[model samples]
Target: MPPAHPFDFGAIDDDEGDTLHEECGVFGVIGVTDAANFVALGLHALQHRGQEAGGIVTHAPDVGFQSVRRFGYVRDNFTDPETMAMLPGQLGIGHVRYSTAGSKGQTAIRDVQPFFGEFAMGGAAIAHNGNITNANALRRELIERGSIFQSSSDSECIIHLMARSLQKTIPDRMEDALRRVEGAFSIVAMTRTKLIGVRDPLGVRPLVLGRIGDGWALSSETCALDIIGAEFIREIEPGEMIVITDKGIESTYPFRPKRPRFCIFEHVYFSRPDSILGGRSVYETREAIGRELAKEAPVEADLVCPVPDSGTPAAIGFSLESGIPYAMGIIRNQYMGRTFIEPTEQIRNMGVRLKLNVNRALIRGKRVILVDDSVVRGTTSRKIKEMILDAGAREVHFRIASPPTAWPCFYGVDTPQREKLLAATMSEEEMRDHLQVDSLRFISLDGLYRAVGESRGRDASAPQYCDACFSGEYPVEPADMVEQGFRPKTAAE
Candidate 1:
């Protein structure tokens, strides 16, 4: 493809680190008039969550459960008439995966998900999002008892556990299986006549249930509901399970449940602006963060501009609170893929310019307030600050909505080492100099919680949130996981 663009990665900055780990995106449909089509549409909306591989498995009276998968984007892998025609059924499940536990080099059609396994007990097809913290330990235990593993995913651990359970019915076995897993996960598994969805005990990931006429759908985000014309239903409670069939949907929880600890990063960096999470609007939550930022770190500037996409709502709130006009000071190129790990420095440097550009007309000669969700390594922010100054911004005042990320995340996010994080090593003034900005302010940790807690209908007042990346109190100890950092390894190194 003509060597791609030089600005694709090198010119980009390491400050573009993902704040949290995302396992994959999941979509399931039952009783839908066009189950395969609905799954296809839902997977399209969740495309940003993962891009390594995609697949769907469907169940019908004639074929039971038929599936097709390939290592590519959903549009490229599942768009053909031949592929879609093979997945005919009124019930189905889909998955888009970005590997966390296994080597991406081993990626093949067989390894792509909706893993179908048949045994003396029953047959099931499963798709999962989020990593199971106990997967490696559990996998070792399962292997000792004669369960053969066909894939390198933690997801297969659940199915093997379900197989080992002595329960006679599928629901009972599923319940037994879930109680054994720990960490963040939203799973959808289907059989010939039944479909089931389950969330981890802490509910660190998002999963919602929706209904469209007689058909029912379950997804990782409300955006899927919008795509399929499904009416909004409540979110799946932490430690809850729902079973769906032609008879309708039924809920259950057979394990001792814990309070929900939804990943706070979802509200900050992930999720679409139009979506609602934990009974709160995502956009409003971010705006509240911005409002709190203005109160906590009032800045002097003529106008406020967000990083684009994720930073827009917070920028708007900051502008309103500070009485600074919000303008489109930076424009994002939506077509640019994520550049967090572009191989070369030159490519990473070019990435900053390709991903976003300073709108000179809006920012020139103004005292600009630049707001972004979070800063990781500080490379891109530095480049951006230099770009704006070159464009005639008199002074650049930087504002961040979240506290400094000093710790690495083990849940599923691919964060780097502690030393690599800018906030962990640099003083506030040092960061300003590093980014070449006039002034800088980061929101306090308490302000973030208050923003969510005080929102009108959110009831975010008392949610158990995973703030380990911001604070040092990780729900689970991850000292052993320090060796698993994302520092690209080479043969000689």
Candidate 2:
């Protein structure tokens, strides 16, 4: 096999990365020899959550601190013995990132995390997994108050806030800093000997704990712990923080308690199928969504097919519930990662075909129902429909597992501008017309809730999960964007 090509992030523009991007993933471990190695494996497992860049920060009392921040995949960067050897320590934290509230594609090394800060007490490094909604305002305030920033990322503000805190302990200072901050966050941090984990008040993003024999570990998902042969513990409660050391772990709550509004999209598309979230299997939930979609939008089709990978479980559920045969109508080039080097305009125009191709023999002459998670800008959907038509499919019907994504996510996920969102601008019928499909139907919000085990469905007054992108019900206000003339949803709009 040829060596992996470097990620040429700048060439393609104009909704090339049309799908919704994940925020980031965080992991840390303590009481283990060469803890950074464990952190690297955990990060590699959670790499699906973020692939642009990765970083690890380790702490050894004698060696002080060792950090290695690099661009691209963890397997290519952190897995090398030489690089791992440089990160020797009993306590360490790591972050796998996608550009959200930071510089987009071609990420700077400074923007890569775990971001380290030298406090009066000792140095602390934080690996944050969510977006900060109020970052712009805080940055202006911090800058005015003599806080010089090194990176454009919103997460860097937490470090500045920590540096200004008067609290004696690093965790205490973190609490003080977090108290003033807002929006979704699940953070993993480390000092000299202690490893820390924290979730925002709403638990909008995921963070879990695990037991690593004589050590303890924290990760963005349980699947990561499984990669390192660690026994799963429990999810760190929303608004709670855990500080772990050689002896044991201590838990604390810094933010006030509220209804946990975990991101609902995690079950729909973001998380790995093997991961368990909210006491439910992510894979099972997706299957349920497909069942619900089939029940709600029963379509007559010769074959039920997934858009490959993310859409597979749902397609199986659709097939099971609808009595249609499930087939691999589309095949993904597994080696072609999310970030690939599109060197020429011809290859760039190939677009979705580079990553996906229709299983021509299977799709030809069939009324195919393509089950996909969601349609963002409809760029990929259009290309997919064209491919299916070119392959001689009699009809193409789209069944989305999640509700129409009409609003931009302010919590963590990187989303297109409101006007750029196909759902935001077009009704379901209009979207169908635009895609030139036989039919396009998305699962209802209530159906989505039920799929995720919310038997009662969504409560208009108080939703159980963060359906901000679907319902425009933001749990936390996006302050900075509002200041810049970005408006929240209104009843009339």
TM-score of 1: 0.88
- What tens-digit string does per-residue lDDT give for candidate 2 at 1-493? 1101111122234435567878689998888888888999999999988888999999888889999999889999998889999998888899998775224543578888999998878899999988888888888889999988888788899999999989999999999999989888899998997989999989999999999889999999999999999998899999999998777889989788888889999999999999999889999999999999999999999999999889999999999999999999999999987554534777777888888989999999999999999998898999999999999999999999989988888777878777777998899999999999999999999899888888434465555888989998788888777876778988786
User: What is the lDDT of every predicted structure here?
Assistant: 0.78, 0.87
Which prediction has the highest TM-score against the true structure? 2
- Model 1 gets an lDDT of 0.78
lDDT of candidate 1 at residue 354, scale 0 to 100 = 76
Q: TM-score for each prediction?
A: 0.88, 0.95
Among the numbered candidates, top lDDT falls to: 2
Candidate 2 Cα errors over 4 Å, as ranges: 1-15, 338-342, 455-463
Minimal lDDT window, size 10, model 2: 1-10
